[model samples]
Target: MNFARTKEEQDRLEQIGELAVRFSERAGKIDEAGDFPYENMEDLKKAGYTTWTLDKEFGGKGISLYEFLLYQEKIAEGDGSTALAIGWHMGTMMDLSTRRPWNQNVWKEVVEKVKKGALINTAATEPQTGSPTRGGLPQTTAVFENGQWVINGRKTHTTLSPVLDFILVKAYIPQRKKVGIFLIPKETKGVSVEETWNTISMRGTGSHDLLLKDVRIDEKYFVETVDPVNNQSAGWLLHIPACYLGIAGAARNYALRFSTEYSPNSIEGTISDLPNIRHLIGQMELELLQARTFMYAIAEKWDRSESKVELQAALGAVKHVAVNASIRVVDAAMRIAGSKSLFFENPLQRYYRDIRAGLHNPPMDDAVIAMLAQKALDGIQN
Candidate 1:
């Protein structure tokens, strides 16, 4: 709700909002057919929105976390699946702008590729180990052979698998006893997607399994070796909550529209004038208002933060509140629409399923709670 802080920001958001409206037109079809939003992504690419987070020098808008979340939230209002699918590439690129874990020239080249509409996302989750954020060592292996690195492993949750120009694969280097990030081109030999993503939710994401069967690339593809778990918090991850918040916003819009128009002979005027419907509408707004405040406050802090460690607790807490609050908002929206919301043709049902996908995203609720508890205990001890 009016997220832009300046005139320029408002203009940018309005432009993206237009794109979101276009994407929303097909969201229902995509979700019902469980098809990838390739056309939606093409729209983003043609509009040059895909490179918004890259630095100005890299031919990008170089927006901050606050601005990125604003744009992402707007996009999700159109299509949550599309928002989530692109969020990985957008957030990863934003995070890399600061982390700079790869060789300087190599990273610059990759950014150039991104500027040219090439897409990228990290393929880290695995069937056996779960999300990489959980500190699970990747079963994927990288071996040096014939003067090149050969990678072998299957990655689950490889979002944008259908059209990712390049995949940043997390693989354990047995010889080095460390994990390395390998850049494997989608067209690389022995690389393939299994098309196994059949989840009932976020179906448009095309998050299939990325299978690498001895896919070999030169040494230059070895971007960097990193610890299995990164202690540093990432501000770009605010995109997750931002997307869910947008979904909630969409639900709120639908419920409000329904309440005002869907009047029965049993009631005077419309349901919007009814006290119980009014109560649900007010509660939904209240929930969204609280969640939005928390998300944006932390986002601004993250943008201005000088230390990652200091923002760790806030990072998790924002995601926790935003995701759970978005769920409540959608539930209330469904209630207002009554059984019609459950109809296969209703967009509300799609919103309902897509919003729940946030719960399984990174920074799970249990981990956030544990971290907050530890922070409280440490504060008391000190």
Candidate 2:
């Protein structure tokens, strides 16, 4: 299958690359202020990036998964937080387009809104529930009443809520014995935002708590039952790895720059001249290549209509490799840079913090290890 980007997609990627460079320059300040990267998002929107994965039927470019991941990696290399935040939007759009059981009318309306630049996000995580895994079984519920659904619950880690036009909320329908997704408008009644995101890394992501007390949604906004297991492969699962990949790349680039410029008084030469420094850089490069190769391979496979079950296992492995590599790369950067890397003003510290967030993502270390062990045992039995 052809993996090369069409000329139009290539031009769009170049534009996104430019935006990423500018966003990177301001990322440190945004993290220090713990403010949302509104300006950066606007730039992304202007570049048609917000709709990068939207369906072509909806007047979007509808780029394949492989192309999308490549673009994500480039943007991430520029600014991890900005890429991390926007990744959710792209993933959300992909799910809405390809996975969520939306009817024709609902799809038409949502597609129209998306064409108008509406941003969607998943408000699935909660304070009581650590991750969306073990079932997104919400402490929240939506009751049907007066020709609409009334939603009530507190959702934590609702990333990008500040700028979201609509949120895809998971809530249980008591009478139906079903959990469904509701497209709740941000301006809906009883929807409130709580400034609860105080983190050492990815501060610019604006992952705050959402208090939904009697947030009403029209019946037309309800989508069909979402398969809990199948949701894992719907493109959004790639975002966590993409974020860490970007962070790892940034850390590697910084180390290279530091080695070439900084001259230690005792060494009597730049660190770049040292064999040890070159060795570390080589190791970092190897890890980056391995992680990226695994990620893009799965993406390419998916784009070619591969089986979801097999890809799910591969996705878990990719996350483990990418996140682990990110941690090692950042650690090496700090050690090579010495005391200067610890300063709050330096980007390395932020990379260190942001990479840790991947540890909390789904298909976590323990789960991935168990899955791999089970697969190995199954192979032995076979």
Candidate 3:
């Protein structure tokens, strides 16, 4: 597939790149203070990047999946935490906007809010269950009564919850085996944010727990579920690889810069001139190039058609490759940097910590391995 960006896409990428540089400079401070990257989000809002995934009909740029991933990779390269936090909203919007079967009026309202700078986040992960990966249904239930639904449950790992204007929550409808997504306003009664996230990695993401006690919403706010097999939802899966690829690129860049500039009195020249250091940089660059190719290939395929099974497998592979590659590249950077890389004062340590979180993200290793095995078995059966 031709991965070249169009003129318009190229222009927008440059603009987002400038913003990302500014965001990266502040990422360290926010990570040190363990505070949310509020300034970075505000910059995204001003740039209208918050609505990049929304439909043009709904007052958005309506960029393609390929372009979206490219932009995400650029932003993530600057600051993985900010990219991870902002990606949830953008990816969610892209999924909701592109997927059909939604009520027209409700869709319109949600899109308008997004256009007006309302950030949306996924409130799915819970305290008891890390993520809905191992057959665990949501304890969060939305009871239908009096022509409305009352949602009551606590959600953990609610990324960007502090500044989110609205949240898309997945809740179980009582007596039904199905799960429904509800659009809940942040200011709704009984909805509160708990500051529970204090992790060594991605500390600036502000992924806290959400307390939704008796939060009521009209029936129209519920997003009906379609058949998982038939439904097309590639945008959500693609964002993970996009974010991780950017991080890998960042690691490569950091290593390159350090090798070129830092010199020891014991050495005749900078580390970049050394054969061993140059070889490591080349290896990291090769990994990034290959991972990015796979990532964009899957994205372009999604743009062309809705193939959930194939897309899911491809996305799983991409995430697996990109994230693991990122970790390796960061580790290589740290190894090359030596003892100084271990200090909190160095940005390399932050990158090292942030890249590891990708391993725990959805489309986990075990699941991906099983899925790949199933594909192999099916191939043999045919």
Candidate 4:
């Protein structure tokens, strides 16, 4: 089922597939307990999977965007929570390496820690301001206190909070009227994680609330200012859709297997022989094909293209198509399962819930549509 075109890609995917098998074995248990997949993450770290996206100069493989998303989708098929949680760290590393927005010394320090199996995720979303993508100024504020920067605010949706080694917090500088990202090591004074993640979806992500009350850090930790709304397109964000697509793949596989095995006395063989079931299966395949084609094509294009700015609309389109298609694929799989999909013991129920989280992830559908509309209007006027 691995559609990798090259031998190297195939070999790498096989390795991830082995790890994913182990993760899949434990997925249901972790979901039932609603706990973070710490063991799965440890496995990734031990296998060097955690630093695969780092640049080659940083003592890592520096895999291409295509390779990254390919592995991400495979991992997600095994466990959506694990894939989604780790994708943030993986994508962040890729972005930092590509952008090199940090001071050279600071970037090297981060690379060293990441090479040593450290994890990171941005704490940007606030309860009041909602998604930082909406251009809402973060309520989180940082000020110069003596020689250090003191940051104070509570950030929600801080994924991987439990085991994060560093948190890149987005905060507003009231004195300067600018927004900047500050790197706060997990053990920094006054940095605390509140156990506030109690969602019914993607429960194992450990997306708790990050509380920073007068958190102190050196001035060097003030990484860079960001114009949230005007930030350039991020190819790394494709990981979000890739994760959901993998979940959809898992649901489709489950439905296929169930169809071939489940039979009733009234039927001749298995439910899979029925025309309606075949039609549903065909539709799911088509949906996956369309999404995967769009995702991989754009990812490969990103790897070769020099202009990410021009690809902004294309990137958003990929996420929009892939995510919506994944939802449809999962929903169809549920239809194939009928009422059994609702059972707690059925993994389809879990898949249903996990995939639903995609709708709320970054690059919200509304924004993407608006962007496309603006592009079309600009095109016509030109």
Candidate 5:
């Protein structure tokens, strides 16, 4: 669908690509250490990259959804965790600023923080509630007392919590009997980040547990989005699939290089000449192209269309195809590498592990399939 529709967008992509190359150089060390890529983030901030998604009126790039996805995929090529981690902040910021769901003045202040390289994310998930996407009430509670909302709960899977200057905490308000997203500053009293992230994949994300014990915040920070339930046309979530596609691309390239350069002593030519190796490479190319087309076309469509209707099934299906295709792409690459792909030192091993993380993201496969099935049934009935 050739979505890069403007020269300004094309130039922005080039600028971000340079930063991605620098991030690529440090991705391995950050992954090996299982720590946040502080230096990589510093470089990104210094380059004025944190303002990409904010509206142009706010002195930011105001990039469209299509441009954002393209850039995110490129960053994922350098480091999937960085791309995925920052996706929450970038996507959430863009969504909030564009829609203006809550307090406008509060958001303006948040934008200033974003421009200054202050990170942010919606801390919704908890150990007991699982993903908010599944539609369970949050365990975190918000109470009004003494001119402030007292927040008391622990949130898990809070990505980039360690570096976040602001957090949109989803908490249950008993008095209102509705969910509210409280904007809590990081330096607020009783707000602390717990070191609980210990996953084998996407280790640099720092998706640790966030503790908000009696954390107090001004009531103006609470925002209630329209149609909270069934509000499913989230273009920003495309970043997740874009990330997997990038990881798959990385694996595919590594396999192609290995096949081209490695020639066994017993064989006169490299594996690139072999029919089986060529077949796997071709398969990966086809899958990647197909998945990318689906992802990018939908993102571009979201930019042009004004419909607020929830394309729940369509949204989930895109993630399903892209992520599953990505796994296959990585598998094909691993098959080509054989035993060498399993070694801890090989980049292929890292890609393999990281790509799997996509499966665990929102829009779980089973729920997606059920939604698609119901859509078909509803269509038939109509």
Candidate 6:
């Protein structure tokens, strides 16, 4: 099912997949303790995954979107929380490398840091407004003071904030009344993580509160104007669906293995021989097949196409369909596992809980449905 185009791409994915397998050995324990998977991040860096998506001109692998999505799925197979958290950095860095908005010196430093395995994430969510993608203005304020931009605000759900070397803050200048993103180094004064992430799903991700009180940085740190009205096709977000699909794949594999081996005294053969269990396995296979087909096909198309259609609706649908399918597949796997799936040590329960969290991620279910309805109505009017 992999679509790696080059030997280098194949070798890179194989290396990442190997690291992901090692990471999986600790995934359950990490979840139970609710701690960030710092080891997993470090392992990925050592495998050169951090620079896989960076442009070749920057002394990196420069993998394509299709290849990146495939590796993301591989990583999720080992640990979903880590996959989701780091995908933000991987995708954003790839996006920024080409269409950089900041000065060359600033961009050059960022590229160097990334090459050296530095993690970065956009801190756009706020306690007041939630995800900035919904067209809500950020309450975080920035002001120019003595050749420096002083920022004061708090952001919620800042995933991987603890390990991040650079934090991109979306803020408004009070004096100019203009909104823009300001980059803040982790060591900048008055910048800290508030240690507030405690969740049932994706608990290994340190998506805590990022607090910045009068965080001062050079004025050149302000970079990239986020325009909600004229956003380009977000093909990078395909990683979201890929991660969940990988989780579902793990659950499916577990169920299959258990069914083949487990036998009760009352049963003449393994549960896998039962018609109902076979039916459930068939169903899970179909779900994964459909999800993988859509995600990879669209990803490859995005890479090869010169121009892309309006992708907001497609991106929303991709997340909605793939996540829901993964959730359903996990549920089926649990049913096949019967009571064993409920055990604390079983991976099925973890998969079930982790997949549920994707329902709350950005491009929410309601927004996707609303967009579909509007598009349908507009088609009728036309």
Best by lDDT: 4
Model 3 Cα lDDT, one tens digit per residue, 1-382: 2245788888898899999899789878988989998889999999999998888877788888888888888899888888888888898888778765578887777777888888988788887766666546688998988998999999999999889988888888875667888888899888999999999988988899999988989888887752322334355667777887787777778778888899999898898898988788878877887888888877888788756556667778888988988888888888778888888888888888888899888878888789789988988999
lDDT of 5 by residue, 51-107 (tens): 888899988888888888888887888889998998898899888878888777988
Cα-based TM-score, every candidate: 0.98, 0.94, 0.95, 0.99, 0.96, 0.96
Ranking by lDDT: 4, 1, 6, 5, 3, 2
Best of the two (1, 2) by TM-score: 1
Q: Each candidate's root-mean-square deviation in Å?
A: 0.9, 2.3, 2.1, 0.9, 1.6, 1.6
Off by over 4 Å in 6: 1-8, 228-231, 380-382
Instruction: Output the lDDT of residue 69, model 5.
Output: 89
189-226, model 4: which lDDT tens digit per residue?
89999999998899999999999999999999999999
lDDT of 1 by residue, 346-379 (tens): 9999999999899999899999999999999999
Candidate 2, superposed: residue stretches over 4 Å from native: 1-10, 227-232, 380-382
Off by over 4 Å in 5: 1-6, 225-231
Worst lDDT run of 10 residues, candidate 1, spans 225-234
Query: At residue 333, what lDDT does model 5 achieve?
Result: 97
Better of 2 and 3 by lDDT: 3
Q: How far is 206's C-alpha from truth in model 4 (Å)?
A: 0.6
User: Model 1 off-target regions past 4 Å?
Assistant: none
User: Each model's number of backbone clashes?
Assistant: 0, 0, 0, 0, 0, 0
Residue 363, model 5: Cα distance from true site in angstroms = 0.8
Decoy 2 TM-score against native? 0.94
